[model samples]
Target: MQQQVYHSLVYHSQSIQAWEKRWFQQQNSSYGLMQQMAWAISQQLGTLFFRQKIKKIAVCCGQGNNAGDGYLVAKYLKQAGFQVEIYAAEPGSSRDLATAVQEAKQAGLQPYSQFDFQTEYEAYVDALFGIGLNRQLDSNWQDIIYGINRQNGLKISIDIPSGLGANTGQPMPVAIKADYTFTGLGFKAGLFTGQGKEYAGKIELISVIPADTELQPIAQLASHQIQLPKRQTFGHKGSYGHVLVIGGHANMGGAVIMAAEAAFAAGAGKVTIACDAKHHTAILSRAPNIMLRDINALTVEQRIALIQQVDAVCFGMGLGRDEWAKEQYQAWFDLIQNSDLEIVLDADALWFLARQPQILNSKTYATPHSGEAATLLQKGTQEIELDRVAAIHTLQQKYQGQWLLKGSGSLILEEKLYICTAGNAGMGTGGMGDVLAGMIASLKAQFKQKIHLHEIVTLHALAGDELAKNGQRGLQAQDMKHAIYQVVNR
Candidate 1:
């Protein structure tokens, strides 16, 4: 069956007025304040259903309307018989702390000192700032944010965490890493890209203003949500085609392990790993459910024979650009080009193809992070960061097929482009790229018989939003595999 995904329309603004108009429409369209309040109340009620009462909650207030959100949350929690403490700013007093102070007085919540927060609270609410933040947070504020993070409790962000830039997905020098970020209006673009994904925990948008009123320009746009295709009860294993994972060197078998595991988790019917002999056992040990093969045992003819049966192939990962790995890339390239199978190139494969840009113009996708993307295009990271859309499109035009540019906000491009508004900054850890390649490969292989490149791109982007369930911090590509199943099956 073809993978199903929900895609939202994105618009670029030439002036402030244009953005304002768009913002007003989105804010009221199921993403406004009523929606946010409903979600918040529902979540709290669920906790209450389990007989877990939130006795004490902390609200970090800021100057913007986000601070207003925190104030409101604190008031509600206090009214619900929960103890509420509001932190207007840093431990010390500031002239600019007027909004927080006024809100605190009005809500009857008291300001907290650093020493006074030794007690554990049931939950923490962040209302520091929203998507409009551009400047970096100062050192003193960073210390405060760190202190709050170190505390043991359920932390919630109103609108967005303070010190987070809602546009670039980059965090301010000091950003409050929330366990859950209640976004305002429509989804903000920056929340899912760059470091934004890691800091903005489980995200849900809340539009506080009426949908019909004029609003500010959108700081960022939310990507489409992934919806899994329904399966027929009569379907068999062949319903989902085979996925071939090609990678894993002697000491780096873990690379193929991660890739294959992700593919299988994404519901690939048959996942085969053509990797180094030394690491085959490791792959099987970690994921005994997959089919692992040794590349050393297969001749070029044998490898090609196996490749012909698979619906899609994932290249790179632990495969070094040495003689053997290079030969594998060549063989894989010839096999893919010769056949009609879908392909996804990553890691060393992308690096190898970067040396020969002509080869990239195939029915394949090159999944590269900022550094890898820059290297392939012979440009600097700054250039790619400045205009991710242009850079990815340039690469797409340079080569054929689709382009999955991994970074702050992973941009998946085909005829049109998509940006994942989910995800967090904490996703900058290792092994994420390998897992992403596996996901694309699995989805492509499963739906190889149906859908076009746009569907594949849509699935990948939407799956990203689903991965935010467990929070964006320390999110490996492997984490996304589970989310894919949930989305596809949902």
Candidate 2:
């Protein structure tokens, strides 16, 4: 048998629905596709139960096709000798659901309207709502969802976690927090970005639709194994490009130093740092390979002359909002405004851009966290986090460049949106974004033939995840340097 590889192609609800309609047209009917989906779910559940030695399961059903899937799961579980109980919510909404209820009843399964919080089960299957949910849950459903969450068991959601917006990834006031989500038909963009990552845990894509169908994907999720082209064996240091890192005001020398170090670690042929003259001695002491330029001492013409020699530039790490920082930014901004130099803007650079928006080239990359993204978009941090996709699009529209929204499931908006799936919570500390900016700049410098924004972001996150293997807490930004070297070599 050929091994199956699932691409991280994500679709919205309407797109999925349209594809399903086409699939159903090719098949016998919608019910037939539903049956195939339920069968697949049952088989998957059987394997899970066997491995965990689970005997009892509670299937939470709503008044939709998702509920019908729950009913079928109940029938299959009962037939497989597991104790199955179906808890129906808002019954008599769909004929398919009604048929499923009758069939499950025939298989000696009883449907209950109310659930006891005290009752213990091996697992709970959330089929309350799927991708079609748009409004908030009512008080009755909220109570039920709350009850399910309060239960002590493995919670699995079918298709999608109930009450999560399929496109927006916004959760209802009370949404099911699933331990595992078997997303059917296709991978929904909502399951991997923004609030979706919190609600939909351990996602497994279930292919209910045909694999060869001509369905278009709205976005792609990053893969684990990334491959970069091999460098020539006889190539000299000049074969790879040089990366210039500009940041690190007086007290914030560590930010720019870390970025410069990361750039060297990420395979930049030459790494240079332009910052306050005070940190020059300290930077050389730590990283001797990194050449230093005193931004305070150098004239604007001299800085531009130096910039002209570098392949790529990374700005804003520890770059403060002071007058000195503004002067440094202005000198470089003036030289690189119309130039095709690959630029990675981060930290205070983003704040600078927010204060005064600039016309940047297509080669520019902005790495902004929620707060910085909100500043750039003129919205609140909460608003930016609420819908990251929309925020990234808005950022791209306002500023004509690639944008990376940094957080859990970091999104890269270039020609199309690509969600990074390799990072962990341990990367939440300071200086991490600076490290990412350096890595991106280094890669951009080395691979001048094409822009690898997606690959660069994925590698950065993968390095963080590799470092997080020890534990999430106290995983420093510097710890990822070795991992970055390893990933770049791979």
Candidate 3:
């Protein structure tokens, strides 16, 4: 199983079967059932150097074609001199399963009825269920999953983890966590968002079907990769917009620095920080290219003088709830409300507006994590987990601007809701939101493309996933700046 770095959608039973039928007909193979699936999996796996060798494999199965995938993988592994054991709890009589069983028998591999984690295993393959799974997993299955987690080897999931809701990304009361997941046919939107990332781990898609078939459904555009605009030989400093980063109270100086540095790294022609005097000195010391000023000392005339030249602004970050900051933000919002200045609202700004509810109608971008989104919706976090789409859509409709609902499957909703198809487990860290907010603001400052907002958000997510491939820690917001540049240029 491989982890997908961006938002994508795969087959959901009906779509996959339709493609498979068309494929078999085209190939003119009479015994194409398990043979075709096995051949596809093997050929795909063979393309990865890291996955070429196998010794032992543990198989988990349910009644669907996903189980068939696991059985087929097990057969392929066994034929290649790898030891494999299959486990099924009342495997049903679906045609897919029967064919898999027949193939297993031919390969001298019989599946067992029970699972034991204590058994020494090199890797585990999840086939419990697929997108059709609706109910909470049984206790026995939970125990098996728990044991699989306790194992000391790699864990792979076929299609999806047996217990994840296909439509919603919610996991059943219990779901097996796979180190990597190989999605068949197409990508599943649910596998990229909410709690989906934690369970799916590294996701790789196996598009066994031909592309000519029109059965593939576009997954929600959650995350994506944006091509960076090229810097022609004739370009100059004014090529990108000047971004004004406003935030960073006395104790939160690092926030403004991070945002400004991120903006510069993201290709801002000029980056300015409207913050405290003390922080201003630190900003110059760390990144001398950044221009810094004290917001409080800026008289009304001076404040107005500064706002006229900037093309885009990023609010919040470490802007506290202090009366002064509140007044500044409110005034800032008032000034920009009627203007066409592109805005990226995050951190305290999001919290403040969410509390006022009535003042959230401006054409700005809002970046909020699940907890922040829950607070704005005035619902428990658990309720938001039940259906992220409804909650995000509710927020998007209530607020006039694009809503980047940040979570496992960070949703990017504008006129149409898009899911991110990229990213990895390593993205589960801090300061990422700050980096994303800066990237979006910088992009708006630089380009006014019809899809600029969508493209930037996608690039940000893909960069995070790329950084994760190295390891988890040390992936700072600053690091993503170069990565973002790379993603956009590509």
lDDT of candidate 2 over 359-471, digit per residue (tens):
76888999999999999988999888777888998999998888899888789888888888778888989889889999999989988636468778888988888898889
Per-prediction TM-score to the true structure, in the order listed: 0.63, 0.95, 0.81
Against the reference, the lDDT scores of all candidates come to 0.66, 0.84, 0.73
- Stretches > 4 Å off in candidate 1: 1-51, 72-85, 89-123, 151-153, 208-311, 317-319, 323-335, 359-362, 369-371, 377-400, 405-411, 414-443, 449-490
- Lowest summed lDDT window (length 10), candidate 2: 1-10
Residue 350 error, candidate 1, Å? 0.6
Error of 2 at 255 (Å): 1.0
Angstrom error at residue 84, model 3: 3.9
Predicted candidate 1 versus true structure: per-residue lDDT over 1-490, tens digit per residue: 3323332333232322244456555654322442356347435534652365567777777655555556556666666667778776442243323443564578677666432474677777776665656667778767777877887877777656677766555566767787777664456555665666678877765434333333333222433434456777998877887998888867577777777877877778889998888876666677777887887788878987898789988988888978877777776776776777788888998888888666454568788888888998999987677556667778887877788777666777765666655445555667767777777788878766354444444454456656765676666665666766665566
What is residue 486's positional error in candidate 1, in angstroms? 11
Q: On residues 1-490, what C-alpha lDDT tens digit does candidate 3 reach at each position?
A: 1124442544345565566677677874534545665567655553432364656677777777677777887788777666788887676867767878788879998788767543787777788787667678888777777877778777777777767766567788767787777776677766867777778877777664455546755344543434454678887878888888888888788787877877887788998899878787778888999988888887777777777888888999889988977887876766665567788898988878876775454458888888888888888888888877778888877766778777766777776676765665566667777888788778788875444455676777788877777786666665776787666666
Return the candidate ranking by lDDT, descending: 2, 3, 1
Q: Pick the candidate with the highest TM-score.
A: 2
